[model samples]
Target: MAMIVQARAADAGAIASLAEEIWREHYTLLLGEDQVTYMLDTIQSEDVIRQAIESGTVYWLVKEDGELIGYVAYDLRESELFLSKYYLKHSFRGRGIGRYLFDELKQVAIENRLPAIELTVNRENTRSIEAYRALGFHVLREHVGDIGGGYVMDDYVMQYVIS
Candidate 1:
């Protein structure tokens, strides 16, 4: 069995924990230790995550047979949906769950009448880039995002037309 849902404010703490876990794994390869620590400290704090989950769109804990597996956070900007972040437990990758999760999110955006969806992914993350491309996301622009550390993410702004 699999379960995934839009988490309410009450689930904020758990969402923060999942974000911390994902960042720890994802940033280790591209950032220095101190920067990674700083990134986590600044971004994964209870205050920030609590606000994001409470006010933004956060889909919590993809579960199989009732076991926790992954999460995603997003925000709507006008007619566009911006993905804040997405992550699965390290062991859960390659199971095609990510695709299913993304599909659901896209439906949510379209059903809500959003015209487009956008997300930024690391330029060096070829695997994710390919996955996004496969899902009909086109590279709208090459860009960089400063994630509040000395480190900045070199990314591609990918867009999917949802209308």
Candidate 2:
């Protein structure tokens, strides 16, 4: 295991690459290639990343020996923490990076004195649901989020009570 670093604005490209890989490897199967591409192109745009940093949404890149392998992007809303994006390089999956990332994010939520952490995951993604359940998050409600056009994020809003 190598020490990981939470990257800053200069690390945007590395995190963007990780985001693209995550979109392709994770969402492409469920959402299809075009949806994945649209998401990557739009959400991972340089301008969008710059805006994220400017907006104070903390983006962290996991680096080992100076090589980027994963990243997490999240934001705080009052007393709640929202996890928007969390992923590892496709090749790095199953090596405990996802678990570590989640743990770290949970800590972030706790450290900020947030009452709970909330997230939305596609209802069809049982793997992610199971993972969240293992980490003590419970489904709160089912809602469909429109990403754009006919693409919608059919998700279960899950929350983890930290305190």
Query: lDDT of model 2 at residue 28?
Result: 81
Q: Extract clashing residue pairs from model 2.
A: none
> TM-score of every model?
0.87, 0.90
Could you tell me how far off, in angstroms, the CA of residue 147 lies in candidate 2 after the best superposition?
1.7
Q: Please give the TM-score that candidate 2 achieves against the real structure.
A: 0.90
Candidate 2: regions farther than 4 A off: none
Of the candidates shown, which would achieve the greatest lDDT relative to the real structure?
2
Task: After superposing candidate 1 on the true structure, give the runs of residues whose Cα lies further than 4 Å from its correct spot.
Answer: none
Encode model 2's per-residue lDDT on 4-63: one tens digit a residue: 575567767767776786778888888889988887878886668767977898888787
Per-residue lDDT over 1-163 for candidate 1, one digit per residue giving the tens place of the 0 to 100 score: 4568767777667767776777778777766568767866777666677777766656566777776677777887887888867778878887888888888888878877998889998888887888889889999999987776467878899999985
